[model samples]
Target: MPDLLVKLSWSLLCLAHLVPAAALLQPSLLVPLYDVDPASGAGLLLRHRAALFLAVALVCAYAALAPDGRRAAGLVVSVSVVGFLVLYVGAGAPAGALRTVALTDALLLPPLTVAVWSAWRA
Candidate 1:
């Protein structure tokens, strides 16, 4: 039950990081997600990618192994999920309707949210 949800969330988070790492190695792999906009330079995108990987690893590991860590990670996951949803809707499909928000941003919603709710109810 709870253990299953936590493990699934952690595994999905790891998968998210690994996918981007593969893309970071190749120039062609990045072009689709990061277009050459004036505000978005290559260096910034690289830095952002690295930061996301770090976050995913740190949070996922903590949530998976530590009881207290799950509470904190659950909080972050809840807030981030809701925030992405709001940002996507407010921006009026800025990144191609629901493409970005619908894909990667959706991974944390159900299991994380349920785990957090269960924790609170416990």
Candidate 2:
């Protein structure tokens, strides 16, 4: 039962990441990799910010309350690191910008995930 819940929570977190990365970041960041117009990219970023934030919030809540939070959190943190690397290298963005984003994700996600998992197990 706990395992299922943990897996579900992890899945949700993964989903949340994908939603924003695809809808928000790609249009703004990835498009620019291909030399798309900055204006259009900004438009996507603006349009999806709220939805993206909402998704992030939902996943955060799930991660906090689910069992196996430690493992889930670790996986999510790994996902973010992998995501940033993919975006940074695969997209051909500047190293500093990618590193900044990657580091931000690393700092924000792991601790929270662990906290939530601990709460759930306790």
* All candidates: TM-score: 0.67, 0.40
Give candidate 1 misplaced runs (Cα > 4 Å): 17-29, 36-46, 95-98
| Alpha-carbon lDDT of model 1 | 0.60
Task: For candidate 2, list the clashing residue pairs, or say none.
Answer: 69-117
User: CA lDDT, every prediction?
Assistant: 0.60, 0.51
Q: In model 2, which runs have C-alpha deviations exceeding 4 angstroms? A: 1-41, 68-81, 92-98, 108-122
Worst-scoring 10-residue span by lDDT in model 2: 29-38
Cα RMSDs, all models: 3.6, 8.3
Give me the candidate number with maximum TM-score: 1
Clashing pairs in 1: none
Worst 10 residues of 1 by lDDT: 31-40
The candidate that wins on lDDT is: 1
